[model samples]
Target: MVSVTENTEQKIIDAACKVFIQKGMDGARMQEIADEADINKALLHYYFRSKSKLFDRVFVEIFSDIVKLLGEEINHSTEIIELIERMVNNYIHLIRERPFVPDFVLHELNRHPQLIVQQIHQYGMDFSKFQLLIDEGVLNNKIHYIQPVHLIVNVLSMCIFPFVAKPIIMGFMLNGDEAKYNQFIDERAGHVVSFIKSSLLINNPE
Candidate 1:
């Protein structure tokens, strides 16, 4: 059971995420966020002192969610292919659920690289386990030799690029058809998994 305070704080954060994504930090107002949260300005202020503070909180939470997802996937999967599949699928779903996140995060990252770097340090994102998995696969002749950083970057780029380039891909490539574009995105995980397996895994069955 969640406490009232926790619930209210989450409500504020959720509202803030939406507002910040739409209007951005410069355009968003505190009263607007309070209204979006369905709470009075005083109550919103009780939870967050200022718009800057609230934006920081929202940014940290969103970034933390991604880091946590990666950490969880790394811990749970035993095989390199399994980890890639899980990460690709879940990452796509996450972006779908919060479509505003990638754009907002990218903007913030450009403006405040230091803040994002601090969050990464705070989270202590360890990729050594993922590296070990890759090493194991290589030793067992399951996959080709690849550095963990390259693997990680490749997977992230494939997972995130579609969403980040939604306008071009959806507008031009998809003919501005949202339904078709959605279907494309929905089928993307399988495509990505297959591509990775075919490229990396020896004798991988199509």
Candidate 2:
């Protein structure tokens, strides 16, 4: 069970995320967030100090969290196929858990792309580990030679495009059946992994 303080904090964060995405940093107001969260402005200020601090928290969360998730999931893989599988599954689930995240990051990004670069620097994001895994796959003759960026883009595009285009996909493709839409999303990770592996693994000499 979530504690009251933790719940309140999360409420604040969620409200702030919505407001920031809807209004951008320039238009979002602390009182509006407080109203949305159903908390007084003083309490919101007590938790976040200022609108700059609140926006910073929400920005880091919506943007930096994915970078962190990718690092953790990719770093833990036992093999190249597992790495690809994990990336697809993990990212799809992340989007499922927080559908607004992609829109929030993309919409807010045009205003503050610099903040993303700062988060990357702050996190010391080392793709070298993931790169090393891919390099080993090539060296061991397990998977076809491919650039990390290509694979990264592949995984991200397959995982994120659905969420970015959710309304159209859910409306037209799924015909507004949310359950069917979720099922399609549920099946996507496996299909993506299979598609990638089929393209790459067929070249293996084994």
Q: TM per model?
A: 0.89, 0.82
CA lDDT for candidate 2: 0.82
Residue 143's lDDT within candidate 1 is 89
Instruction: List lDDT for all candidates, in order.
Output: 0.86, 0.82
lDDT by residue for model 1 (14-44), tens: 8888888888788888889889888898988
Candidate with best lDDT: 1
For model 2, what is the error of residue 167's alpha carbon versus the real structure, in angstroms, after optimal superposition?
1.3
Candidate 2, residues 68-186, lDDT tens digits: the string is: 88888866886878888888888998788778678778777776777777887878867787689888888887778788888888888988998889889999988899998889888
Candidate 1, residue 30: Cα displacement in angstroms equals 2.2
- Span of ten consecutive residues with least summed lDDT in model 1: 1-10
